[model samples]
Target: MLLTIEDLTKTFPGTVALDGVCFDLRAGEVHALLGENGAGKSTLVKCLTGVHARDSGTIWLEGKEISPASTLEAQEAGIGTVYQEVNLLPNLTVAENLTFGRQPTRFGMVSGRKMRAEAEAMLAGYGLDHVNVTRELGTYSVAVQQIVAIARAVALSGKVLILDEPTASLDARETETLFQVVRGLRERGLGIVFISHFLDQVFEISDRLTVLRNGRHITTADTAGMDRLELIHHMLGHELEEAEGRRRHRQGGVERLQVRGLARRGKIEPFDLTVREGEVIGLAGLLGSGRTETADVLFGRTPPDRGDATDADGPIDLRTPRTAIAAGFGYAPEDRKTDGVIADLSVRENIALALQARRGWTKPIPRAEQRRLANDYIRRLDIRTPGAEKAVGDLSGGNQQKVVLARWLAMNPRFLILDEPTRGIDVGAHAEILKLIGELTAQGMSILLISSEFDELIAASDRVIVVRDRRHVSELVGEEIETGRIIDAIAAHENGEGAMTP
Candidate 1:
């Protein structure tokens, strides 16, 4: 093994991010670190990269016990990390970004000519020789920027390279390009740690798999023999039997919202959808499969170029989020941190946000009413907080998610859009969110659910719509909504014969 972590542990004030987690990486191989959010993947990565100090653990790099107190120290000790968002300066030229800190110097001045040559040679080893080293990095595509980031990391740390969600923003062709580079790096005897939510990508590139759940190491095994369903069970820590029991059988009422030819160019293809009263319509797909895009269009975050939608109030033009809200629609975005919650505000303030917005700024929701709403939701959703005045940022990931849901629910919208609502939360919180979904649906609240977890969708959805390459390819209703069928639909090709190569 080129790198090994034994009994690694780290903790915060109220949470143990990692507990006795062990991992190893062999040279010339790709090791995939798999886990859901709050599964200790990030914590482990941070500890390894010297971002966080481990409470207690032993890290061996090439048979030498090492303790790196900073990222620079880790890099110097032969470890490098390239994040999803490239850390390189976008305004600088590619060569400058690569050789920013360690630029070649001559006669007490930076040597631009030598720096550019070094960058060119570095990129050439990764088959990125075509990229002009002198061009501004921001001008190029995200895939190229990623390659540049990888090149820099490799130059700094020759042994271990950690790629965190490297292909999240990349397209199909771009992903293939990045994979070719990664394969070459592996062939060169570099130990690459691959972290991503895309299972297809994992199975394609990984030599070994390590799963973590709730900050504990579950298992480490070869990727070749591992079944997809089995891997999911490890990450989620539950059997298919329990997930099956979550399958709901609610009878939908009259059509609440009907959409026809809704689309945004380059985002999602024109699609038709119908969400009825008291129904949970699930959008299932791989990451970047237009699941979030569909939600955005439905919520009027990105208004459709050409589409017709009608509700009980007749034809409704969803030009913006405000219009959507007026139409009795509420959306809980996939990323709660940036888009959903105002972490700086109190729990009470956060819960009352949507209602206050709908009521207009001039007409404030009275303090008493705000208190009542917050108290009601805190008790109803079981949000673990000392008081409504507490800052939402101080809460756990699961509680923060509940606060976002509470904010939207206070508006009592007829339609709700939940995108990855149970993600990153603990098992207990995950079940609570699912139960809440069922209860909300029972009360005639139409929901458009988007989840990467197929079992969750299978359990909660009355109907499942499969999205592929930003297009709605198939829809499964009634008994058709099962794990096998959903996976088949996702892996199936355009002609419906076999799996998609990507």
Candidate 2:
């Protein structure tokens, strides 16, 4: 092994980010680290790169035990990392950015000519000779900037390279070009760690895989023999066979909203959907699969360039969140703490926010009405707050999530979009939220539920739409909405085949 980690543990104030995690990187191979949210992948990377100090463990480089106190120290110890976003100075020239800190100096002065020559050599070595070294980095495309970032990292540290979602922002052609560069690096005996949410890319580029779940190392296996379904099981911490017994019959409902050709550039691809009254349309996809992007467009957070949306009233313009809210649409975002809840405000104020916004600032709901609305939802949703005047931030995660839902429900919108509604909550809260979904739909409410947990989708969704690479590839209805089927649809190649390949 070129690099090895044993019993690595990292802890925060009240949570353990990594627990007895172990990983190894061999020379001339691409090893992929796989996990969902809070899986300790980021913590492990930070520990290895000296961004976060490990509470306990050992890191061995070239068979020598080493501990790096900083990123510079890690680089000097022969480890390098390139993040999804290019971290280089965009205003500076490529040559200057490459040799910014370690420029070759002459007579106590920085030598510009030597720096450009060195940068040119570095690019040529990495097959990036076409990049103009004298031009400002910001002038180039993101793909080019990403390649430049990779080249700079390799030039700085030649032994072990970590590419964190390097192809995230690139198109198909650009991703292939980046992969070619990575293959060349692996050929030169560099141990490369490739991290990405795109399973297709993982199957194509990685030689081996390490899966982490809930801060513990789950399994390490060769990527060649493992199918996407098996890998998903490891990452999601669930068994597919257990997905049976929850496939219930769907209730055919009336069409509530019709969306045609809705899309936003660089966000979600053009797609058509028909949401039905009393129906739960589940958005199923891996992280970054445009699930949230789809929700954002539907709720007018990211306005679509060209699309027609209509309700029973007639054509509706989804130009902004306010318009969407006015059109009987509501959205509870994925991140509750950041986007959903206003921590400083009391529950009464938070619940009345959307309603007040819709009614306009001048026509504020009377304080009596606000209190009534807040107390009503608090009792109905079974919110565990002591009183409506309690600060929403002080509530538990589950209660906070309920408060967000209560805020939207107070609007009495005909359609609501819930993104990861049960995530980061306790098991009791998870069950309660699922129950609430059923109850809401029973009351003729249309819902778009976005969840990573397949069981939740299977249990609550009348239809499951599988998204991949920002496109809605497959839709399963009735008996077809099973765990394996959803996984197959997600893992299917863009060529429409059920198998994934390079």
Candidate 3:
């Protein structure tokens, strides 16, 4: 084994983050660390990189016991970590960022020429020749910056590399490039620890997989022997019987929100859609297919250049989120941590935020009322937290998402737009949230759902609107919401072969 982790245990104040988790990595193999957001995957990575010392464990590197006490020590021992968020200095040039600490100086003077030559060679090796090494790293796209970060790590001659969701923001083409780089690294005998939410890519690149659920080791299996459903089942710890019994509702009733000739310059085209109460309308397409953009336009985050939304009351103009909310519309943005949650606020404060905003901050909800509302949502959504007083940031990713959802639900909006609300959450939490959506619709709420998971869209959505290249292409109604149909619609839209449809 290139690396062995035995009996690894880590605990926070009141939570056992990891429980006797064991894993092994071998040279020339791409080992995937599969788990839900709070399933101890991050904790295990932190422990291995010495960001958090394990409570109890034996970590062996190259057949010798090695317990790194600090991140620097781990790096010195041939371990490199690339986090989900790029960690390079934005202001520095690519060359400087690459060789910041290990720069080679001639006669005690910084050697710019030597650094540029080395950086250029590194970029060429990674199939990235267009980016200028002399330019500031931030001047390049996120994909290029990610490549530079990877090159810097590999240049350190690290025997093991841990990549945490490196392709989260990358498109398909960029992801293909990343896979090639990873494959080259594996061929060079570097053990890679890959973590991703994209299951298809995981199967494409991973040689072996180790799954974790609820902070415990679940199983380790060969990627070749596992199908997508089998992998999902293992991660969720559900039998085939339970998987088959998941019931999803269908669309019912007349249109509640109607958008006519919706257009956003350079973002989304003039498209029309009708969303009905007691139904889930899914927006389907690949990345950059204008799905999220449509959500933004509907929520008034990105105002439409030309459009009108109507109810039985007739056409209403939504120029801003405040207007949208006042008109009984609520939106749960895609990035919960950045756009949804208020990190410093307590759970009670976060849950009551939207309601408080609607009533003006000066007219604060009474302490008793706030606590009651918070407790109600906490119990209703099954959000795990110590109490209402706990900071929203202190909770797990899934819980944070629940807090965001509660913030919107507290307002009791007529139209709810959820943009990948369950992304990066656990299977149990995902099912719970999906079921909650169904329950809400049954109670007569209208929903516009956007998700990258095609299967999820097909299952939960009553109708799907497919978009491509900032234009609405086609609408998939009842009995036509299959994966193949969705893909074909997207393709037709991209090729400009379909008439704009609602």
**Top of the candidates by TM-score:** 3
Between prediction 1 and prediction 2, the one with superior TM-score is 1
TM-score of each: 0.71, 0.61, 0.87
Off by over 4 Å in 3: 89-96, 104-114, 130-144, 170-174, 197-200, 225-252, 367-369, 372-382, 493-502
Q: What would the TM-score be for candidate 2 when compared with the true structure?
A: 0.61
lDDT of each: 0.85, 0.83, 0.83
Per-residue lDDT over 166-186 for candidate 2, one digit per residue giving the tens place of the 0 to 100 score: 765565667888999999999
Q: 157, model 2: CA deviation in Å?
A: 1.3
Model 2: residue 321 alpha-carbon error in angstroms = 2.8
Question: What's the candidate order when arranged by decreasing TM-score?
Answer: 3, 1, 2
Q: Which candidate should be chosen as best, given lDDT against the real structure?
A: 1
Error of 2 at 122 (Å): 2.5
What is the Cα-based lDDT of residue 309 in candidate 1?
Answer: 89
Per-residue lDDT over 374-484 for candidate 1, one digit per residue giving the tens place of the 0 to 100 score: 999998776867689988886655578789988988988899998888754544456667887888888989888988777789889999988989888788897889999
lDDT of 3 by residue, 194-302 (tens): 9886788899999999999878999999999988787887776774334333235465687788889887888888888877878888898777778889888887899
